[model samples]
Target: MSTETPAVRVTDLTVAYGELPVLWDIDMDVPAGKLMAIMGPNGAGKTTLIKAILGLVPPAAGRVEIHGGLYRDQRHLVGYVPQRGSVDWDFPTTVLDVVMMGRYGALGWFKRPGKRERDQALTALDKVGMADFRARQISQLSGGQQQRVFLARALVQDAQVYFMDEPFQGVDARTELAIVDLLKELRTLGRTVIVVHHDLQTVRDYFDWITLLNVRRIAGGPVDEVFTSENLKLAYGGRVEFLQRQAPCDPPPDAPDLGSYPGRIRP
Candidate 1:
């Protein structure tokens, strides 16, 4: 690893979709070799921020610099693992096949992956403890297994900066532990790992730095310093109280009557 400079730099970043602003006046500096977590409530623009950095979503204003250069200039140096729900599990593909796709960006327009690419994919799968399932159909895997495959796919990219969104969601405790260990190894190798995480209880244990966002950024710094009651209040102040009187997401069929609460409940 070259370790030349900061992994990512954002200045006055504002993102909008069809004229509706989602993020505003965002300025951040992320150094290399740290595990940084983007923490926020639902609809807080965490995913939008990641997409903007990856060039998947264009920013309305401000600039993004990667490795001390323009985004396009450093595109190859970044890897991404989007939320698992964003992918189609029904797609006909083997685990190895999907992992090999990560090499496509490097192979470019017309080139095909060869033995070296296959080897790299296999190595990535091994790192995530999914090498035995490489030949299996991706659709047949469990949620955690599928997540591991996606992580393997990103690892195959061999990028210095990795952006993962909700990788731990819907995963088992064992799988979550495995992922944290993998992230630790990546940090040891001087790679910058940025993750969008939701679980407030484990935020302090898993991340070195935290960025608290709620449509707008509240505070961002080390977990011990930034993950305060005030910041949590800013992130979920109104929604928490509102949601308390409501049912959790996707309530069960025989669950309590939501109408029993005082507030509104959708049919």
Candidate 2:
């Protein structure tokens, strides 16, 4: 086992919506410099897990640590991209303005973002192929374009650990590829990235580590070890009962795939 400190750790974490539980006694360790995915079914608390680690939601029980420290003290080391649906897209903000918000943690309260911050934001936008749309109103962009902006925002943070909620949710195929490329780049740079994902088909291609969750954690580790037919069946329930081979994705009837999906779990 690797003795290095984890980039993110959750210990016996539990979260609730009033009396109803969202996550229960979850424990996970995301190693540094890896791309990890948190995945589960429709109401399985995937997003809730990330939110708890980022401290957006109060945990009813347990603790979370980032780089072996409290999240509040480690804020500068982290960046977050929330679900696009959770944002008020119609709000009056330009693409560049949205990206600049990432600089706020480093800029402190009284100081406004200056040319240096603007340049950083622009460069991050360029990295995501959205530089030309810098001045465009956020609401005018398509779903894919909006997601690109969100990625740029996170990139500009230059954080060592990034937490993203469904970055590929509504993106076009091209945007999905672009995001994947960027994530690969981040991993190469030795940054840790944690994402909440739904498409089981692409999990192997996009992530190095994965945590399978259905309210509580089912399994977590290197994708090859934990993302198995047995673990997937456990997390997804009857949705994968007919998976004859661990290598191909024969999604159950409820998952919107009428036929096979490519990039299935490879043996």
Best by lDDT: 2
- Candidate with maximal TM-score: 2
Residue pairs in clash, model 1: none
TM-score result, candidate 1: 0.87
After superposition, which runs of candidate 1 have C-alpha atoms over 4 Å from their true positions?
1-4, 238-267
Residues 152-224 of candidate 2: C-alpha lDDT, one tens digit per residue? 9999999999999999987888999899999999999999999998777777778999999999899999988
Candidate 2's TM-score: 0.91
lDDT, candidates in the order shown: 0.84, 0.88
Query: Candidate 2: which stretches are off by over 4 Å?
Result: 239-267
